[model samples]
Target chain A: MDILRIATSGSVDDGKSTLIGRLLYETGQVPTDRMQQIEESSKRRGLSFTDLSLLTDGLISEREQGITIDVAHIYFHTPARKYIIADTPGHEEYTRNMVTGASQSEVAITLIDARYGMLEQTRRHLHIAHLLKMSNLIVAINKMDLVGYERSAFEAIKSEVESYVNQLGASFTLHFIPMSALHGEGVTAFKDGLSWYQGAPLLDILESIKPRNIINAEGQTNFQVQQVLRPRGGDDPDFRGYAGSLRTGSIRVGDEIQVLSTGKSSTVVGVHKWGTELNASGPDQALTVLLADDIDLRRGDALIAKENDLATSRRMTASICWMDEQPMTSRKKYIYQQGSFSTKIMVDQIQGTVNLKNGELKSNHQVLLNEIAKATFKSASAIPAIEYQEGNSTGAFALIDEQSLNTVAVGFAERFA
Target chain B: MKISDFPRSLENEAIYIFRETLAQFERPVLLFSGGKDSITLVHLMLRAFHPLVPPIPLLHIDTGHNFPEALRFRDELVEKYQLTLHVRKVEDTIREKGLQEETGKYASRNALQAVTLLDAIEEFKFDACIGGARRDEEKARAKERIFSVRNDFGEWDSRRQRPEVFDILNGRIHPGENVRVFPISNWTELDVWNYIREEGIALPSLYFAHEREVFYRDGLIWPVSDFIRLSQDESPERKVVRFRTVGDMTCTAAVDSQAATIDLVMEEIAAAEISERGARIDDKRSEAAMELRKQNGYF
Candidate 1:
């Protein structure tokens, strides 16, 4: 079975953890011991019923404060597919954590409290989901039990969100479900509530959505060299192979390829996966490619189909989400790492920061913690890259503070400047 | 075109991580515990550097309370692969440093293994310790990153964790500090079993069901071993049982089953009610037992 990655986002008290806990429970993923642990934890808190949220709130500080602090990955499975859910914190200050979780997810489940309607955090999550180009957005209107499961309460919030999303011109397939995660209503199946709802339950909607594979997209072959495998002491003596995963498109034996860094051309003599040879290989498979000609190719070098053109530049404009408490300013130097490539880069300019409430780019000189902004960067050396919309592997990069060595910002390349 | 297979995808991800660790770190070692998870890591590492054996050595922090079956299996594996094996015993650390050992029933050397591990790290100056930790196994592990950094004292500061994006991992660290690399952090318990069955990877005989002297305790089965101090009232009974996870004899509990093969084990796990870690007695000490151990450099 294939894996389906999902990210959950909701403000405090919206019951994100409860929804996840209910999903795990309904799927029979929660074991008896864990169930007992949560039951006892709930009892220790003096609660009459089991508080399922204790399962996802794993951190000590989180349990003490009764709020999620960071992203926790929850794994479960059904007969059809394996599920990986990133339970991201919904607090305003943890937007960077949300981005980090949502970056690898195929679907975004945005939780909305029925009583409070649409809040700023809800809009912010939706905005980030859109920015990440997520196509499936499941808007779970949670806590319907408090609103009496009224169709009117659901419709009012639905219309408001519908108009706002339309204004943003998002292309996500929105699936709205009204239910109470605490009571296990309308989660896995509709039971004793929400008779007015016509859509499938939350679990069904999740199962129906197909995980997009960028590997199959029609694009140029891009393989970033992760390591050069040279088993000089084995059965065969002179063996040199460029080892890496195919980031985009496909590659076959006898295919002519060009090295992006050295501009050297070579023919693919063999494709090897763990010493076994294959005629051809598809994307996302970690394999080694042996070249007919001996060319100097090292890590941080890219091998592409000779005919395809990948942009190689020293300057590029990217939209970045600042994750560090120290604000990002122009002319500050950091390490820009894309795929296996790493280079020293200077933030040339801070163009503007995106206003989450509205889809507007506000002019800003500095990007504070958890804020999203567009900026231009000048790398010390030219490197191959693609537009973030084109592919994920070559288009994304992490900015690291040279002094602290902490990942300060995650940026998506918009275009080469 | 060959579509990506589920297990193969996970395998490729793990292989990528293994190669990346080798490329990034100056000195790296695989933390092997002779458990199914670390055994799977060894299998993947073998495939990662096929013609040539994995250049890194294997480090095993022996608690001296381990099962004979696990220790025997560990030695045979090292011999078969011609692997460089480093065994540092907690028994040695306790005697050499005059460390206090826990007394009474339920006292375990599981926690003491961390001290031996940290001492080993310092002795060998290993920059990266690749482990077989999976996020699905525990709640605290769920919040940890693939490249988790630790201080000079081997303390894990969860609050100061660096954000990991996409498949990119940052292995950069300061001197005297090391990163704990988990290549199989994404694999679930079932996923490991499924892959093990698919690949036909050899495991210890303890994984399969056999008649063993065990007794009931805390609604769970406990094996009769020399290391564990059984209560006066407790009596050993011969029953067909198997271990889901292989830890020290004092902490790792057994399960009553008749599954004598890998297929049966997988089927039993799929139908089992309790989680894999449920059999681990160390985690049952307190709600934050695993977290506390992890913060203090427990692997």
Candidate 2:
């Protein structure tokens, strides 16, 4: 079964948790005992309806506050597919937390209230998802039951979002569905509240989609070694292997490859995986690769294609979504890590910040909490900054505070000649 | 190529994490125990750097109450792969009487392993210790990040944690701090077993079905030879059983099943409604058991 990683984001009262609970419960993915536990807990609280957020928000404080303070992983497998939901917070302050959840997700399900068409936070989440290059933008306009199950209410919100997303100019494929996460309407069942509507249920739509291939970089190939193992006592005493999982593209035996850092040349002796030797290598497999010679390659080094696809430049400019509570300025030195390679990068300049409500760039001198800004960095050493949209491992990097050693922001490297 | 050549997403994700620790941390170590999860971690790590001898060291906190099979497997794998193995025994502390052995039915030195683990970390000065802890196993674990940082005293401050965005892991630790990386945090028990079976991964034999000396207690099977005293209510019974999880034998309970093969094992997990940790009697000790343990340096 294909995997669909979906992030749930909405306004505080939009019932984001209920939508996830409805998805899990309606699909019968939850076990009988867990459902009983939910039922019993709701009874203890003297509530008319069972609280679904308890299924995702596992913290004691989160359960007591009746709000999700952190992102939690909730899984449910259907016969046709498997689903992993990143139940992110809907509160305004936890926008950073929502990005943490949405960053790993391929699809973003933005929960909106029918009573309130589009809130500021909704736009912020869509902007984050789009900026992060999440292709599937699903506006799950929830709580249709409260609005007399009106078709016009859903249509108005959908059109408004469509116009805004167009202006955002972040490549996105979108879907708009009216849903009642609390009542399990339009989410998992066929609803005729709007006779003009003809679309698959939320579950149906989820199952129809294929798993987003991890090999997003079609032509680009970037390989980073984890470790080199020389089996000293093995039959081939000179057997040298640069072992790591291939995240993108492919490497085959007899292909000419260049080892990074040292700038040495070697041929792929073998591409081994699945506890056996393979003639070829594919993306994201735990494979041991044998090189023709005894190369001085270790972890943190890379094996690049001969076609010239990499660089060891000590400087880069990228867009960063600052997460720390304190204002982060370009003058500060932070530890920037991309893939296995990392360096001490001093923020040289903050060029611009995008307006959250309107997707326009605001002139900025610094980045504050939850602010996305373009910044140029001068590094203490050479750092890897691959395109975020091209290669996930090589493209995405984190900026860490040297004093606290806390990862304050994640950035995508934007390069120009 | 085999039809199973396509790797499971979670397993590949974990291998990628192992590579990160290798690529990033200066002094990294595999926090190995005799559990299936950690064993799977070792296997994945091996696959991560196969053909080449694994460079990272292996750190094991021996509670001294482990099943003999785990000890045997641990030794063989270490030797076979020529690993830089380091074992810190609780018995060494036991000789010093650092912890007095319990005498009653609830007698278990499982909690005392934390001291030895802390001692080992201080001795090795390991910057990153990788383990096989999954979120779905427990509620406290559910809130855990892929890279969990520990203070000089080996305390987990769950209240304050770094927000891990995308695949970007924050492995930067202060002079006295070490990060505990959980590569398989998102994987389920079924996922692990499926990957093991797919790769034909080597595991300790105790996980497979076998006739063993066991006892019935609180509607569960407790390995009689496990390192704990039994209550009078519990009686011995020689039954065919298998282990879902392996920890301190005293606290690790076995289940009655005939899943002698990996295929049957997958079938068992598919059919079994309860979680793998549900069989771990130690975790069931209290409602806040895992959280309390984590706070006190249980990785």
Candidate 3:
């Protein structure tokens, strides 16, 4: 069964959690005991009906405050596929959290309150989806019941969202679903509402939408060695395999590959996966490979096809989403990590920051938390990397704080400078 | 090449997490409980660092209420993989801390293992501890990050967690602060059973149907073991049963079943309505039991 990773993005009161809860309840995925638990909690909180929001609000602070503060991983299964919904916060300050959800998701559901057609927070979400390269967009016109289930109301909201997305020039499989998450109409099962609206229910669309297989880069073969495996004792003294997951493309025995960082080339002699030898392996396969010749390779090294033109760079420009409370300053040193490799790098210059609310780019000298900025960075040592548009895993990097070691920012390589 | 050349998704993900732990942490250890989930973790660890013995050691917190078969399985795996095994006992910790173990009807050592584990972490100064926890197992775990950071006191502050985006795991932490890594967080209970069946991994005998001395308690089957103090009304009876999850024998209940093979076990799980954690008596204390335990340093 395929796993469909989805991210739900919308402003507060847009009913992301309620829709997810209805999805779970309608699909019979919510067990009886769990439902009883939710009911009791809802009653304690003086809710008139069973508050679905209480289901996804797992943290104590979230329940006490009655708002989702972080990303909650909600899982449900249909006959066709399994779904992992990364329900993200809708507040503007939680843009980093929204990016966190969008980064791993193939589809993004940007909800629109029927009363409020489209808001700045909605545009902010769509912009991040574009930045993260989300392939699918579901513009769910929620709370149709509040508007008397009028067809004109749904159409207006849908076209408003379509124009906004088109204005942003994002190419995603656009879907529009009109539903009331609270009343459970047109969500998992269609109920008596909006007879003029003719589209598959939100749950059906979610199940039918095939998650784009993107474990690796598109149209490119890239492999990063995560670890070096050498026989410890005489049991397999001759075995020296490069253990790593294929970021993209495929590799087979006898395939000549280049060590990108070192410029050394070697032939694949064997491909082993969990005691089973395979003739070939492709993206996301965590396998071990033996080379025909002995070469020095360590973790964070890249192994690509001999013909590919991946650059070895000491300086590069990338679009970074700042995550830490501390502002990013020029000439400040941090650990730049891509794939499994980490190198000391200094911020050269802050090009500009994106005004997330309006999608405007402003020349800025400092990058603050939850802001997206294009910045040039200079590394102390040369490293192999690619542009984010070229390949996500190969091109994306994270800045690690020297003191806290917390991931301060997420960056996508734009060019080798 | 066919897409079949790609490794299974969940297994591949677990391997990826294992590799990340090895790359990021200086002193990392795998928390093994001799349960199927931990067993699966060990298997993935081997694959993650194939052609060589896994560099990390195995840490087992013995609650002293474990089944004999589970201990035997743990020993065999440690020897087979040539892994360094670290065993911390709750009984020892209770004696040293002058802590009182629960008694009477709800007596159990399940929660006490958390103190033992915290002590072990402090003693060894391990920066990362890999666990086999899955989100589908419980609700609180559903909100856990893949690289969950614990403070110096090993407390999990859910509201104050680092935002993890994409495949990039933030393993950064200050000294004395440790990270609890859950590689199989996305996997469901059925996913685990399916993987075990596909891989043909060995499990403890308790997972299979066998005749055991058991007693009825709260509509669940309780095993007659050393740690359990049976009441006069609760007499031990022979029953054919198997364990869905292996934990402290005093707290982990058994389910009535004759399914001895992996295929039958899969069938039972598919048709079963109750969750795997439902059989865990410790979780019956309250609605927020797991969350409270997690806040206080329980894996």
TM-score of every candidate: 0.97, 0.90, 0.95
lDDT of 2 at B149: 89
Interface DockQ of candidate 3? 0.51
iRMS per model, in Å, is: 1.9, 2.9, 2.9
Docking class of 3: medium
What TM-score results for chain B when candidate 3 is compared with the true chain B?
0.97
Under CAPRI classification, how is model 2 graded? acceptable
Better of 1 and 2 by TM-score: 1
What global local distance difference test value does model 2 have?
0.78
In the range B114-183, model 3's lDDT, one tens digit per residue, is 8999999999999999999998788788888899999999999876677776677778788899999999
**Sort by DockQ, best first: what order?**
1, 3, 2
lDDT of 3 by residue, A188-291 (tens): 76678765667898887887776666433255666778887777685888778888878777787888999988889999888788667786445567878789
Ranking by lDDT: 1, 3, 2
| Model 2 lDDT tens row, A11-71 | 8878888888788778765665567667877888898998775567666667677877677
Model 3 interface RMSD, one decimal: 2.9
**Backbone clashes, each candidate:** 0, 4, 0
Choose 1 or 2, whichever is better by lDDT.
1
Q: Clashes in model 1: which pairs?
A: none
lDDT of each: 0.87, 0.78, 0.83
Pairs with steric clashes in candidate 2 = A229-B52, A229-B53, A246-A284, A386-A395
